[model samples]
Target: MLFRVDVAAAEPLADQIAAQVRGGILRGDLAPGERLPAARELADVLDVNLHTVLRAYAKLRDEELIELRRGRGAVIRADADAARLRLVELARQFVGEARRQGLADAEMLAIVREAQP
Candidate 1:
């Protein structure tokens, strides 16, 4: 009943929230047809405004990652494709940020290799 997420990139908070929920669906952390918390509850859990959470949910609905049902909150879709796209985008962003931070190719590669898969 708890949801926590880190804010990252230049993406809006709503988009960040949507991306995380999309990823969770793809990774099976949030199973298909599972019930999502109410926007208010999620907002409280994430310490974001209700409007922010609703925006995320709306975005997810548009992406087909979740569907709004009467009195049932949002439900996960059977499949969500947004995850792969988000991962790729995030990787590119990370690479760009690392380069901007003056991390050399060797250093980046070392860090990647050292990271646990």
Candidate 2:
């Protein structure tokens, strides 16, 4: 998967890396069982610290979007598709509920923003 980092962005490098990988999986650019680049290699490519890449990998693994195994590297989880589909379904339901409640898109999004940590 192609990864890029905005060095000048406000977001942390690790978070940026994790977000890109997550986006790739959700958008079908990265397939289930596809192995990601080794942390060191990705860190080199992105010109970031090795630990930053590893931290990003850990976040993905913790979210169950990917799996990390000894001698196996990091691979996208087989169930990621199901998880992504469920999230999409949930979002659709949320939008429907918001519409039924007469909430405008901006208002609904504002509520979401307020609820976010």
Candidate 3:
């Protein structure tokens, strides 16, 4: 999966890296059991600190989306559910956009209800 980060963006570089990986998983570009690039290598390619890539991998590990093993590096979990993860990511984006639009919880709920068929 291709990773890109915007230094000028408000979000941290690590979060950006994590998000791209999540997107890759969700889109089936990264498959189960597939090993991700080494953090140090990715750091050099992305021109970010090794800690940044490590932090991103750590986040994915914490979320149970990837496994970090000694010498194995980071591997996409065999049981990772892309569909569920996609739904969760979508929900987060929806909520963030709604809040940016000055929407309240009730309004967001109502909008979702209206969207349901």
How many backbone clashes does every candidate have? 0, 0, 0
Q: lDDT (CA) for every model shown?
A: 0.79, 0.86, 0.96
Query: Candidate 2, residues 38-114: lDDT per residue as tens digits?
Result: 89889887889999999999988988889999989999999887466558657867997999899998999998899
TM-score quality measure for candidate 3: 0.86
If ranked by TM-score, best first, what sequence of candidates would result?
3, 2, 1
User: Which residue pairs does candidate 1 place in steric collision?
Assistant: none
lDDT of 2 at 89: 51
Cα TM-score of candidate 2: 0.71
Candidate 3: residue 86 Cα off by (Å): 1.5
Residue 87 local lDDT, model 3: 88
Query: How well does model 3 score by local distance difference test?
Result: 0.96
- Which TM-score value belongs to model 1? 0.62
Candidate 2 ranges beyond 4 A from true positions: 82-117
lDDT of 3 at 40: 92
Best by TM-score: 3
Q: Identify the runs in model 1 with alpha carbons over 4 angstroms from their true place.
A: 7-9, 79-117
Estimated TM-score for each candidate: 0.62, 0.71, 0.86
